[model samples]
Target: MSVNPVVRISKVLSLLTVTLLVLAGVSACGTSSDSTQDTITIGASLSLKGDFSDSGLGLKKGYELWADNINKSGGLLGKQIKIDILDDGGTPAQVTTNINTLIHNHKDSLVLGEVITGLAIPGFETADRYGYAYISPGGLTGKITAAEKDDNKHNVFGISLPIKSYLSSFDQYVLSLPADQKPQTVAFMGSQSPFATQQLAFSKAEIGDKLKVVLDAGGSYPEETTDYTPMAQQVVNSKADIVVLGSGSSAEAGAFIKAFKQQHYNPKALIATGGPDEGKAFLDAVGGADTAEGVFVPNSGWYPQIKNYQNDVFTKSYVAKYGGTADEIASDTVQGYAAGQVLEQAVKKANSFDNAKLQDVLKSASFDTVQGPVQFDETDHTNKVAIPFLFQWLSGHLQAVYPANEAQANPEYPKKTW
Candidate 1:
């Protein structure tokens, strides 16, 4: 009862077509539901209140701007990525609670925000426990990454430059000068914050035995120490040609400048590292920019024209949303936005959001973000490769002065005679 060869072939062809059609239907259905799979969650933790609010606020705005720009542009992976923000009121206790809350709230998957290094010190375990990828935008504590030698880190990524970011720049800046103008004797200053000691030590390691650090004094800058008469006089007596102030607050630098100026001893060079605003505040509090002429500091993001984080679209939308000019932006915002872009690219590359599928897709993830080229090291889930710029204060404004070609302005000394 064998069928004819032609009939048999016809039946086989029909079955093949039907099977292909069924697969097509299933794939189409999956495509239709991509909206569900495209959704990715990002997280943030920062001080919304208390002492560090100014920078914290800026960090928040940066994150929001990053998130807003992404969401407006149809999001990533064909789905809108939602940012889950938690304010940690500038206290370690609050930070711990917020991390726990975000991990619990997100139900397993998680993203990270700026938590003071000290506060986040204990929470890495929680992230490892939950399989969350954590990125820190602001904390530069070198230990964060160096600790990778231990088992606590796998998903932890630190976007900010290590605490040593400033040490080399300041050292190089001084040494780069003509040998005649180089600063062989300098002063290192910071108020007695818990982090201050480590910062000074880091700066000194670079100084080595080559430079003479005349004054390495610190005290609480937030309290009522109106006059810096003693500290200034120390700078004067030591005949320090340079001053490197590393206070987290400007008032500390202002006091040192005022006291030093009164003594009629202006050093050959002065450098500060509280970012741009801190430099300006120091100038404002200590008469004007004239006295603090020869200072350099690190700043946030690239200029808008460069189309970096301050790109045309991001700049326009950020100003419009925040109701202010876009001159000042935190690196955190750039980092936050970059994180979103990473998630988006990962989701799209995966072409499916089965979490497991997403993981495979992101393992080799890379993308062009507002900050620049972003990618992750598989062993360590951090955007470790992107660093910050060294800014110099010339005339009245802070400008990028490192990397040779990126020099927006050149270094100069007002009181330090050439």
Candidate 2:
């Protein structure tokens, strides 16, 4: 109907305003919804710099590898996976901050654990506060699991063997040796790191009485200590038959090894909680393979040749992507990939991206990864299905050598002189 020009103009303006408001609303909703529907973002804080940089970088590579593999083969739930990794600089405080920022920015993103236990603990706590599942690859200390028990933080899950049982296979193998071959005197040396300290405590309780305690320096020094000659001298002075070092990194282990070599102190057998299992990095840190000969380290069911879920693919992919032989692949890389595996399985099983739903699925489900089978204990969320193995540096490679059944090579006992 014909009307006044002024009235017609006012009505036209009103209609245009309403149309714009509806378009803005749809745009806002799409921005938020498309993020989740098109891509699943995962968050993690890693020690990409500082002391744990070597392992942290390896872990980052593994995470990226997993994401690449998933994206190439129809990503999780038909959506691409995006990993938002932040550098924690190997500090506990920064890890906490990184995790907080990650959760704050993307409330629905899942969290992957950090490299060291010290960093992972804070990361886990932050994720728990947000009620997000935290799947850790290298947080093996029992303290975290114990804290989870006390606080009932079932959101934290460890993909590696618990620290309490890290040395069980080594202990069993030593005890099974001939009476004369069995170490009669032992020394326990560990940095003040929770992972190392816990391993030291367990070692003392498990075999302290069986063997003469020559030196118990388990909690003698802080993890950041640069000089290890003093402690190495103590071990030499004690002249222990065997040395069990609760080292937390390849650098720490290398320091002690170099100190021992300088003093020409050689024990019948020397095993560390970490370091040697790091592959070529450990060998390089300790002055090549000859110097690392016969050293033992515990592994959480991962080796390049192990016949496990997609191990061949993972190894081949790692080599193709990183340009290194299978023997040089770091254990940290395997752990990181396994953590991704667990998360991928949980998402598919629940058929949901909700963190709460994924948590529930992880609690009761068993998953297989490059490492092996992973089934978390209902009470502690520690992996109970995978058995830790003792690996020794033999013929320039770290090979499994314990429990008779899993032995890839007979242990080179009475370790060769450095």
Candidate 3:
């Protein structure tokens, strides 16, 4: 049965051709599906190992929790999300490097997370240049977004209160207070950072003819200094009726309050903005619940004690997962969750992962999340209602004490003297 050599060779070539064609068909199908489907990837940069590490870790937890929930619900657009993150070490240069790595190396679709205000500019610049839509759950620098918008850089959105609105709104609330309760004189103190300075300027403008400034003491103390006694002494000497401290961090804010108390110079009201007044850390830093009495801070997130439909839902879920009350969770945690919510909603409304389309959805839509209604102004990307009621420390917990309807307890108007 031996065949001619040419005929045998011809038969072998035909079989090889058929086998190769079948293999090519299978390969093409696999490649097609891979190109069109799979997990969606997002990128984030945070100060996970440096000065702002606590809040940065909180933000990461919030993002992870949101991602887990979405995946459990069958994922977004039928694809699971993978968040690629990097620690920036809380430096502007490091932030810039991390952002570049995320955008260029990882080729991620979106950017999220928080960096300190002073260190965020480079990140903003990178997002703009690359045209990756970005949002932060915690950054509050109005000028960053405002400047970007002016230059036609519309890829950025900030979830926290805008610097302008944050200062003006607080002053507006003070002005709305009953005439007799309003303090005649005020003292302003804080880090001399750009955001703090802007806050002071805006508050001064809002309080025109309404209050007098006795001590404009701030920026005098370097951020590295732990002892705020020198600044506290100036504030005490001024005998200001009201004291407003715009601290850069919880530790600094707590130090200022402790120093003020140690000096036995308690003003009628001592209101503070920034990290220190937000949650448990500051209270603990200043020597526990008993010593933290009467301190007032804005209720930026709906705490567990607040009775609201949204608050109940978030509180229940958060407590069940983390085994702690709402106040125990870092304030930035809620913010990071809110940011993920906004991003998910935007993705759904747009029905596309295209940056331009997502940006359009963000600018036009209002999302109702655990924090409440989130609406952004397209011009500057400022949140319309980021900050809600003001809360005062009562007993060992924070209680809503303003707007009557939202008040959980009566406010200690004069803030008790130490």
Candidate 4:
């Protein structure tokens, strides 16, 4: 049965070649499977329509900037992350519907979304319903954070401005003032708004025996607001030096500030708790740094002072990749990026898309944002709090002036009481 030597050699070579082919095919499949598993899914709910459209679009772009950059870096946890977006059309009812769909579709996708706080409330509850961790990129209300402790708040989280807490924190400085400088009575004025409600809730909790609120005045939105002059005069007559604004960007606030100055009832402190937008717009609208000059615009961070912040990695890379000058964009974009980073971290830690697991990871999660380290409490998820920087209009820019440690520039007002 012995074959010729040449034939035997040929047969042996053919067997070796077939064995190698089988091994190569198996190796190729293993690589393909690994590649498939390396992908992670992230989702968002944005207001793509209705009022607040301009700001909503800006927020969407900000989130995209972070998500795209992270994916470019091959994503987190050895997985290439993908972001899925849904537009809520700026209606709470519509927002609720969108959330339903998002949770259904992304029951498996990690949610990285926000509703512009005032209008995006339904989407917030949606996160609560599905137990999916969603970072609200622009919504800042304490009620939302309080919801985290409720049975319905399992997946609710936000990286938005702490407008309420910052307001209360700012009042601490007001309370500590020497008795002579501190006002015996104060005024709380706000345009009628949900934002105002949060401001009031926070004030009730924090404003101590320092100043009494004499004039509890407010204006309705776009109506009953024929003029804010009367309200302004009332605030002036109350002899209150400290005025806590209710809403962040109330046109009435600017009008009141103007009226107060015109009547020569300058207050020692004009504290605004709205996002930087309201603060900037009001300061700019009031004209002459001297008119709204002595006032303080309270916010977490603005891009101009970001160079002094500890977030060099993101700030540098973001400014370089994004076309806008860092001076022009909100330093808040850094926080938006930090939120995205949190999502990345959760996914890596969870190692699976199980909503429960992701929720667990976000719970008790403590990590660094562009501003500072953020830790979520089991009962409360408000993370990353820093001293509110009071920006006084110095030169043409709103520069940080408080906490001497972070004073980028000197205060425009050494002291004032109108």
Best by TM-score: 2
lDDT of 4 by residue, 1-418 (tens): 7889999899999999999988865543202223357676566666667544444555665667776777777766667766566777766677777667655645435666663554445666776565556666543566565544554455666654565655654666666566776667667777665556666557755773456777776433432254767666777788775777664443545677768767887676777654334434444567644565556666665435455334565656656866644444553355567677666666667775555766787776665556555556455555544446666655545667765577777654334533
**What does candidate 3's lDDT look like per residue over 262-347, in tens digits?**
87888877766665445677777788887688876654546566543255656666777777667776667777887888899998
Determine which window of 10 residues in candidate 3 has minimal summed lDDT.
27-36
Candidate that would win on lDDT:
2
TM-score leaderboard ranking = 2, 3, 1, 4
Q: Model 2 misses residue 146 by how many Å?
A: 3.2
**lDDT (CA) per prediction:** 0.59, 0.85, 0.72, 0.59
In candidate 1, what are the lDDT values of residues 1-418, reduced to their tens digit? 9889999999999999999988865553212223346665555667677656555666676666766777777765455656666777767677667766766654424455563555455455455455555555543465555555476555555544455554566676666677676677877766554345455676677774668877766443432355656656766787877776665546666666667777687677666556344433445666765665656665333544455643677768776886544544444455555555555565578775444454465557666666566555566544446555666555655567775666676666534432
In model 2, what lDDT does residue 332 have? 90
Question: Clashes per prediction?
Answer: 2, 0, 0, 3
Give the residue spans of candidate 2 off by over 4 A.
Answer: 1-36, 106-108, 150-152
Which stretches in model 3 have alpha-carbon errors above 4 Å? 1-37, 168-170, 177-180, 222-225, 299-301, 305-310, 385-388
lDDT of 3 at 269: 75
Score candidate 3 by TM-score against the native: 0.85
Q: Give candidate 1 misplaced runs (Cα > 4 Å).
A: 1-41, 106-109, 146-151, 191-199, 217-239, 249-265, 277-293, 299-301, 307-310, 346-364, 375-384, 414-418
For all predicted structures, in order, the TM-scores are 0.74, 0.91, 0.85, 0.73
